[model samples]
Target: MKQRAQGSAGAGTPPGDARVPAQPRPADAPDGFRERDTAVPAARAARGEHTHSERPIPEPRPAVQRSSVRGQILDALRTALVTGELKPGEVYSGPVLGDRFGVSATPVREAMQQLALEGAVEVVPNRGFRVVERGARELAELAEVRALIEVPVMLRLARTVPGERWTELRPLAEETVRAAGTGCPATYAESDRAFHRALLALSGNEQLVGIAADLHRRSQWPPVRRGRAYLVADAAEHMALLDALISGDVDGVRGLVSQHFAGAG
Candidate 1:
C-alpha cells in the first residue's frame, strides 16, 4: 500500500479536498461564546478606517425625563409663588400642587425641595412645604446686605471697567425698563435681577454675582403691592447707574446705587 502524504485526510482523500470542514466564523458562533474578529480590526486599523462597534449605547431616558419634568414643575411653582397664588405661610401638599400642575407628586415634591433650598419654601415633615412668609423687615435686611456687598463692587468697577463695558450694559438696562413697563411685578423682578447680574458680572467675580443674585431673589419674593410707578422708578435707576458708570462719575454711581437699594428696602 502507498504511504499517505503528510497532512492528507486519508489514503482515499485527494489533496485540498472539497469536503473538508472549515473553521467557524464569529457570526456562526453560539451566543455568549462568539469569537472576536481580530484580523479584520487590525486590517481596518492599518487602512485608517473606523472600526467602532455596531452596538448602540443606552441612554438614561427615565432620569432625563424626570429631570425635565422636575424643572418645569419648579418653574411653575416659582411663577405661582411670584403671582401670590401660593400664599405666604400656607402649607401645600405635593399631591395638591401636582394636581394643579397636571403632574405626579414626585416632581412637585422635587420642585418644593428646590424651593426650600432657595428660601422660598420650608419643608414640613409628613405634610408638605410652607411658602415662607417674608415680612418687610426681612426685605429691608436683604436690601441692606445687598448694598453692603454690591455698592463697593459697583463703585470699584465704575472706576476701572471702561466706557465700552458700561455701554455694553445699556441693553440690559433697557430690558429692565421694558419689563417694568409691562406692569407685572414678576417680569420686572426678573429683569431687575438680570440687570444687576450683568453689572456685577463685569467685575468678573462669579461668587459675588451668585451671592447678589440670591439676595436679590429673596428680597423680591415678598410680593410688591406698590403700583407700576414704583417699578418704573426702579427701572430708571438701572439706566441712571449705567450712565454714571459710562461717564466715570463715581459719586453719581454711588448715590444712584444707594438710593436704588434704599427704595428696595
Candidate 2:
C-alpha cells in the first residue's frame, strides 16, 4: 500500500502553500487516493540543500505507477465520479484526465473501459467517455435490488455467524467512522464500501459479495453531498446495524436494513 494524504483537496495541498511539495503516489497502492505531502523540503533547506541563490526542489506531481497505472487511474476515476467531479452526461477525454493525474492516455482509456463495464460511463466513438446519468428511478431500483439481496443474507448471517466473528469486524466499522469524520469524499466513499463488503463476506458467498459490492459502488455515484453531521449519523447507523447483527436480533437487523435502504432512496 502507498502512503498519501486522505483529504478532499485531491493531489494538491490547500491553497496559499504553493511551495509545499505534492505527494508522490506509491508504486504498489491500488487506490490512487491522494494524501497530504509528508515531504519536508524546508528541513532540506535548513541542511543547506538549497541556498538563497538557488531554487527550492520542485514538488513531485501526482501520478500513477506504470506497473499498475491502469488500476490506479480506475481508482482515481471512481473517486472523481463519486464526488460528482465527473458529472453525469458530461463527456471527458482521456488526455484530459491523463493530464490531471500526470499520466498518459493509455491507462486513462483502459480505466474508462472498466468504468464503462460498471455502467458508470459510456464510451463515445471518435471522442471520449461520458458519465451515465443516474435518475431517481434508477436509484430507487438499485436500492430495491440491494434490499432484496442483502436483507435476507444479513439476517441469516446474524443467526449463523458467531458473535465473536461479528465482533472482529468492529475495526472496519470504526475505520468507516473515522473516514466519515474526515469528510474526504474519496476516503469515506471507499471506506463505506469496504465496511459493507466485509460484512457481506461473512456469508462466505463470493458471488453474492461481488454483486453487493457492485451495487454498493453504483449507489455511490454522485456521492452524498451532505455535510459532516449527515456522515456522522450515517456512520452511527452502520454501527447500530452491526450491533443488531452481533446481538443476533434478526428482526432488528431486517428492520435496520430496510430502514437503511429507505434512507438511501
Candidate 3:
C-alpha cells in the first residue's frame, strides 16, 4: 500500500524536482524572419562591389588559347560573315584577318583553308577567300532534304506517340509563343529550335537527329537576314502537328509538316 502511494506521487510530479520548466524550442528562427537581411549585401559590397576600376573585362580573347588561336580566328571570321557584318563577294586575305584577330598570318591561313573546305568561303590560288553568299538555291535544297528526312519521321511519331507523350510537349509550345511575344530574338530562336527538336526527338534515331540539326543550322542564314524567322511558321506548324498527333491524323501531320518545310525557300 505504501509503494502504491509512492508510485502515484511520482507520476503526479514532473521528472525534475521543479514542477515548472522551460519547453524545448527550435534551434534557430527562420532567416529574415526576425533579423534584417543586412549582412549579405554589406558583406558582399565590402568583399567586392560593381564599381569602376574593378578592371575592364580584358579584351575579347586573342587567338592561341585553344585549337591554337588559329581555329579561334577562323570561327570569328565565320561569325562575321554569317551574321552579315561581312559582305558577300568581298575577299579577305590571311594578313588582314590575322590583324583583325590579333593573331599571326599562319592561324588566319589555317582558318581560311578550313572555311573553303566547308564551302563557307571561296579560296583561289594566289588570292584570299571570299565569304560564300547564301542564295535561294541552298534554302530550297535544305528544305528538300528536311522533307525527305523529317516528314516520314514525324508521321511515325503521329502514329506511335501515346497521348501522355503528346501532353508533355504542351509546355514547350507555350514557351515558344511567350518567347515570340517578348520580341527577344535569341530567346525566340532557342524556343523555336526547341519545338522542332522535341518533335524530332520522338523519332529516336540518332542519325536523323544529326541531319536535322545540320539542316537547321544552315537554314538560319536566310531568316537571320530577314530579321523575322522560320520561327513563326515553326510555332504554328508545331501547334498543328500536336493537334494531328493527338487526333491520330498521320496523313494530315505529313502534309502540314511538309508545308512547313516548303516555306524554307
Most lDDT-accurate candidate: 1
Model 3 lDDT tens row, 169-237: 888987887776665455665676777788788878878787787677566542444434445656667
Model 1, range 1-265, lDDT digits (tens) per residue? Answer: 2445644546556444423333356665665752234555555555555778545558779989999999999877877787788899999999998888898999999989988999999999999999999888888999899999999999999889889988988999999999989988878877888899999998889999999999888887758687889889989989998999999999999999999999997
List the candidates' TM-scores in order: 0.78, 0.73, 0.57
| TM-score-better candidate, 2 vs 3 | 2
lDDT for each candidate structure: 0.85, 0.82, 0.70
Error of 1 at 194 (Å): 0.8
Our model 1 lands, by Cα RMSD against the true structure, at 9.3
Candidate 1 collision pairs: none
Candidate with the larger lDDT of 1 and 3:
1
Over 4 Å off in model 3, which ranges? 1-65, 68-82, 94-118, 169-191, 222-233
TM-score of 2: 0.73
